[model samples]
Target: MRTRGALSASGASVLLLALLVLVPIVVLLAAWQQEQWATWQHLLDTVLWRLVGNTLFLMVGVTAGVLLLGVSLAWCVATLEFPGRRWLQWALLLPMAMPAYVLAFVMVDLLDYAGPIQTFLRQWLPVLPDFSARHPLWVVITLSLVLYPYVYMLARLAFEAQGRAVLEQARILGDTASSAFFRVALPMARPGIAAGLALALMETLADFGAVSIFNFDTFTTAIYKSWYGLFNLQAAAQLASLLLLFVVVALWLERRGRSRARYSEIGGRQTLRSRPRLAWGVTLFAFAVLFLAFLLPVSRLLYWVIDNGLMQVDARFLNLIWRTFLLGTMAAVLVLTLAGWLAWVKRHQPSPSVSVAVRLATLGYALPGSVLAVGIMISFSAVESWLADLGVGIVLVSTLAALLLAYVVRFMAVGFGPVENALQQVRPSLVEAARTLGASSAEVGRRVYVPMMLPGLLTALLLVGIDVMKEMPATLLLRPFGWDTLAVRIYELTAEGEWQRAAAPALTLVLLGLIPVMVLTRRRSARLS
Candidate 1:
């Protein structure tokens, strides 16, 4: 009777959650009901095609850049031995600690005409050509530098999991090392590499901060312009729906690319291959990437903080940190709870309906935050109006509840991935034993599952918390009045071109982001070892 009751309750929750997720998508689609033909015509005449062209261009450039950087770095770290190879394996991930926007503004600060780089260059070479910091290529490079780890981390695992045996077999068949890598190892790692590529592309599509800094127009930027610049929510929704189409197409292509391939890992401790000249060259290349991506940007941020005293942590700074921490904690707990419940239900029920609902529920992670923000606000406005009509007088739009809901929708997959992996490690036999011993469902969960899932739960919390802290687009659009976070603060300061003043919040975000990067590095290290 309890088992049936639990199943019914879980199914209800899953269905409700799935519906809640679908609300935003539905609202975004229904936004066309209120026709804004003038706005559509203006967008089409002026900037619509430009947005599409720039977005596709950015995607193509980032795709090539990340593939080159991620795959080569992953290959070098996973299969080759070189000077500083062990340290570089994890050090390469440090770029993930810097938000692409932070790097974007920093690059502009240092390299733009008014900044130090050009100032110094002009002193020696008076006729230096003026270079635009707002170039679209810079946007692609900035995003690729920060986003490449998504590809590298996964690709490294794929290569490492293949072990030395497969490569050795290929070499013994008279294949050169380069030929063996291209033909044998690369093809086998295609699924993982593709998965990583998809993630990187999704992030690129969803990015608002980086592109905004570069002044490069894309769908994300267009959505923002429509909502804030033009004050048209429906227009924003229209643009968001278009961006959603891009995301769907990217996901479909990624899925189709890997659908027919099957990969089996030959698991063994990979013996690192050492080639002296190639090893040193790889070391040089890796160092250059790490320096440009992580070290240089970080040094500049630190310099801005110290050289410019406006960033001194005062009462306002503390309040910003406190609010950011509070929001991150709240969102982390809420997302983890939902994710854990969903994972548990899937474990117990394992039905097709539940699986489909869970997938739909987590699909929000692929969506741009601007898309989610517009959809959610539109949905909330309807709810607020309905409540007002019923005399409840409760408000939802621009409230903390709305913001948290956006966070949950945007980050459910982030929390779910860790919790699901942890839950999968819990033995079914152990669960059955608990059931046979007369433990109630609640008791079994508390006594058996809680202890086992603690590590993953903590991991989920940390990940979700950090992601919430760094998130810009949703927070910018959905935050309540006077509830500005570090991310929002950075965006505001950067928008005003106040790079020096923004250093405090940007530095704080980077430091906080490092916690998760360190966690990932440690986990990856353990696996490789």
Candidate 2:
């Protein structure tokens, strides 16, 4: 009877989570059926192919670049002893703090005709043409720099987990260092690398700010243009739907990759692998990666912030910062709470239906912010119209309510992943013992689970907070008129060619993003060491 009651309680909690997570998706799907079939048909006939191609190109480019740079850096830090190995391990993750869009701004500032890099080159060479006009490849390079850390962290974890025994065995078997890395270490780390690449690709597809500012024609940017630029929500939704299809493919690939590349821990104590000392050429190469990827963009932002006097910072800027903080904090709290619930359900219930619902809820993370913003608009419009007809006065569009909802939708997975991971590590017997002690399900959760999961919950909060602060399209579309967040302010300033004015907000976002990365990296390092 007690066992049955525990199971019943678990089922109920799972059901509650399923309902909360499914609501927005059902609303969005219903709204799509109601309005978007025709527009989707039109897109199929017109620009769909081009949008697909552009999105694919960017995805492929970004994924490949991130994998190469991220894996290399991880390998160097994990297996090779170097001068700055300790610092570089943590420093590699710093780029994640800088959003792709802000990096886009910095890249444009440095590479554009009027930027200092070009100015210096013109003075020296005099034959160098404008870089931006002459080369669009820089956009891809810039984006990869900011986004590669996703892959780096994952690959590093994989490498660390593999320990030194496997690699040493490969070496003893007469394999060269390069051969061992390629044949053994790389293959062993494939799952982690794939996970990271999937994240990077999802981020690439969802990117609107960077691609838009670079004058790129990816689906996300195009979706925004269709909606706000042309006043055609249906057309935008259609583009978004196409983007959603691509995201589905990426998610499927990630799932398949993980399933096939499973790694098992060997039952033995492990030691940290000593790294080979970097030769002169290799040292230069590592320095170059750090210089271009981290130093350049950060220096530009710092320069702008310092060059622009404090007097130039206005009341509006301060207000935006405060607003960003409040909204981001609120959204983070909500996301982490819901994520904890979902994670608990997944861990305790272990039913097919519950698992499917949790996975579906996380699908929102893959949807482009513009696409999700459009979905929110359509769904909110329908709700408001229905409420108005019922003589109720409720408006969700252009309000903080809509913004928070969108943030939750887009970033819930960020919180969910860490909490789910943490929860999985908790022994099932611990929960059973709590229940056997005559505690109710809720009580067990409060006492046993919540206390144990605090670190993960905090990690989730930090991840979601940083993501919300740097979030762009959803905030742009959903924010109330006369209300602004730091991200929006930065976008506006950068859009107007006022890069210096955008520096403060951009710096704040980078600083916030760095905190979580530092915490996670330190934790991982401690575990490995």
Candidate 3:
């Protein structure tokens, strides 16, 4: 009976989480019930088509750029013998530490006509044409540079897993190295590559910061403008609903691609041999990517910090750091608790409905932070109104409760992956022994599972904490008065073209983000070893 009670509790928790995820989505969809014909007409008459076109164009450009950069680099790092193969492989991932918007502002600062690069160029070549940093092409390039690591990491794994044995077979069948890659390796790695591409594209679709920094308009930006600029919540909701459609499609493609790729991984780590000259060339290529994507932008940020001195790190700055850390901590704990409960319930109950519920709960990660911020606010405001009509008064909107809900919705999946994997690692015999010893499900969890899952739990905590700190759109929109985080600070500064002032917060976020990247690399290295 005790075990059944524990199971019931866990199941109830899962249902509640599922409901939380559904509320925002349902609210966004139901927003159509209110007719804002004027706003709709203005959007349609002016910027709707342009938004669609620019969005599609950015997606296409980013797709091409990431594929080329991600696939080629993955191929080199995974298959080739290089001078710094080991270090280059890891260094390539450092770009992931820099958010697209951070890179956006840095690039715009450095490469703008008035910035250092063009200024230096004009001194030598007087005929140099004026280049605009806000060009759509530059926006794509900036995003690609930061986002390609998603593809590189996944594609490299796919290649490293199956490249050696298959490539040898292709060689024996009279295939040249180039032809073998095209014919044998590329096809086999397609599903993984597709999965990674889907992720990059989803991020591209959801991006608000980079596009906004570049003065580029997409659905996310449109949604923001509608809400804060136009003062039309209905218009924002309608835009969010449309953006959610794109996210759903991207999510479906990722899952479908993963399903097909399930059997593609075959184990081997042997690398292809390369000549000394070619190896150095590969080293140079990898270094160039690392330099441009990470090193250059970071160097520029550091320069700004040094040039500006300690002016930015005053009392207000300390408070920003404190609030950011506190919020991250609160959100991390909440997400970890819920993720643990979901994992435990899945382990014990194991039903199709439970699986679906878990899926729904985690889907929040794919929804743009902007979409979630708007949807959640609308949902809670409606709840407050309904309660008021019942002679009950309460406030949720603009509260820490609302902000934390957005954080949970956005990051539950980040914590769940680690915790679920940890649960699976627990030996089945140990679980059965606990049952034989007459422990209830709750006791077994507290005694056996929690202790064993500590490492995964810690990992989840760090990951979710860092992610929440880096999160901008939700926190920016939902934060209560004086609740500015590092992300929000950077966004505010960059919005007003204060790139130098924004450097300190952007650098702080980059440093914090590195914690997860280092953790991931170390974990991957340990697995390989």
Candidate 4:
């Protein structure tokens, strides 16, 4: 047990953190009784069902597409041996660096009537009609290509981590290779696949840019339209609350489905490399997936860079690079500082209320960025009003401080999870030993915990930095004039159908995003080996 004083300090910390996190959510919810219900009923009678239907359809389609693409590719990469398999294992994850909205832009542009493909077709076969890119299903295909790598990375790591004897036992029972895979390997990897699906689904639900580009009115787009178009913040808040309910339900279903079985046969001698090979067709299938998933978007950007050449790299471009870097760095430092401190507080003093508060604080990552932006706008507007009554001038929106605060709220969980896990893995005996030697809490953290936690701390920083660089919706709304980062620039250019201009920033974002994924997988591969 900790000292009474320490316990009191921790309880206070929990209340403070939870209050900060919950105020925005509570404010959004309070819009219900304060606003008129005439518009709410009108929304239900008019476009709400259409929005719900479109959103649900996209979710189902994207989930199926990612599972098919991600799981099949993961199985092939883990089980089959062939040419280029070594490189493909990591290279397949490259699509994760390509944001779904960017991929949507590339796909729509290339398939349009005047693009290269249709132009070549007209030159050759002139009788055929123009390519049509209007169907909403294209959104599903585009999102899946970029997002499948979430499932691919997690499922591959999970498949590689399990012992091989489980499969061999299935073989001894006269099970076919396919049977063994379906009945044995798949179930064993359910936990990891479920986790990956949850992440992909969360992104799918939170998606605003891609759906907007494609003219598909999902709930996120509706939220923005309600606030920005109708100027009805109340309607937007209600839409956001409904969207959040959808996310919570989806997460619960995934968890319950995955809770059916427990995995205990974890470590054994036989491994993914040592497993028997299937046909070489699996390699061809994987190659085709890589072409569609990664190569298409990248090749389009490469052509842009090649054509524009040095003309694209000017003072304005350099400023974007600098501002993006500065924003990412600041956001990373803030998330790490708050997340590390909160996690350390929990480690030193564990109580049920504090644990629940920490969990609530982490839920921001699940809410859509547009929803968060609306909540933030409402909360800040109230503060500004109060300050005005106090005879003081204050501007929070369109300020760097507000933008960074939203980033921390949206992404702190990315930093906190690794910190908590790293701290948990340290032997409690080590801490107790340090305490017995009359070390203060800070001294014990420095002498005992810091060395072991440096890697995780660095990982949290890099991940949060990459996420901040790629973050779009909140930055789109909150950034002050002249504060356009790379992602904001990409969204702006892509929105205007200027793919050539967007290509430069989009590619830069991709390169930066790839660094963290590469580092993370390398660490995982080392651990599994």
Give the best candidate by lDDT: 1
Question: What are the per-residue Cα lDDT tens digits for candidate 1 across 69-110?
Answer: 999999999888999987898999998889999999998888
Model 1 misplaced stretches (Cα beyond 4 Å): 1-5, 432-447
Q: How many residue pairs clash in each candidate?
A: 0, 3, 0, 0
Arrange candidates by TM-score, descending. Answer: 1, 3, 4, 2
On a 0 to 100 scale, what is the lDDT of residue 32 in model 3?
97
Whole-model lDDT values for every prediction? 0.90, 0.79, 0.89, 0.83
Cα deviation at 178, candidate 4, in Å, is: 2.1
| Decreasing lDDT order of the candidates | 1, 3, 4, 2
The 10-residue segment of model 1 with minimum total lDDT is 520-529
lDDT of 2 by residue, 1-529 (tens): 3376776676676566555445544554554555656666766797777777777778778877888899988887766666666677787787877788888888888877887877888889948753563244766787788888888888887887787888788999999989999999898888998888888888888888887777777888778878888788766765676677788888887888788786855443355555455544445666777778767777888888888864566787778888888888999999888888887667755778778778767767877788778877887887899999999999788888888888887887899988988897679899888888899989987898788888888888888988898899889888998778888888888878888888888887877778888878777767756
Query: What number of backbone clashes does candidate 4 have, counting pairs of residues 3 or more apart or in separate chains?
Result: 0
Clashes of 2: 3
Cα TM-score of candidate 2 = 0.89
Worst 10 contiguous positions by lDDT, candidate 4: 268-277
| Candidate 4 ranges beyond 4 A from true positions | 41-46, 123-130, 266-279, 431-444
**Residue 425 in candidate 3, Cα distance off native in Å:** 1.0
User: 1 or 2, which is superior by TM-score?
Assistant: 1
Q: Give the Å shift of residue 474 in candidate 4.
A: 1.0
Residues 202-315 of candidate 3: C-alpha lDDT, one tens digit per residue: 889878899999999999999989989998888899999998888877777777766855445456777576767788888888898899899998898899999999565789
The estimated TM-scores of all candidates read 0.96, 0.89, 0.95, 0.93
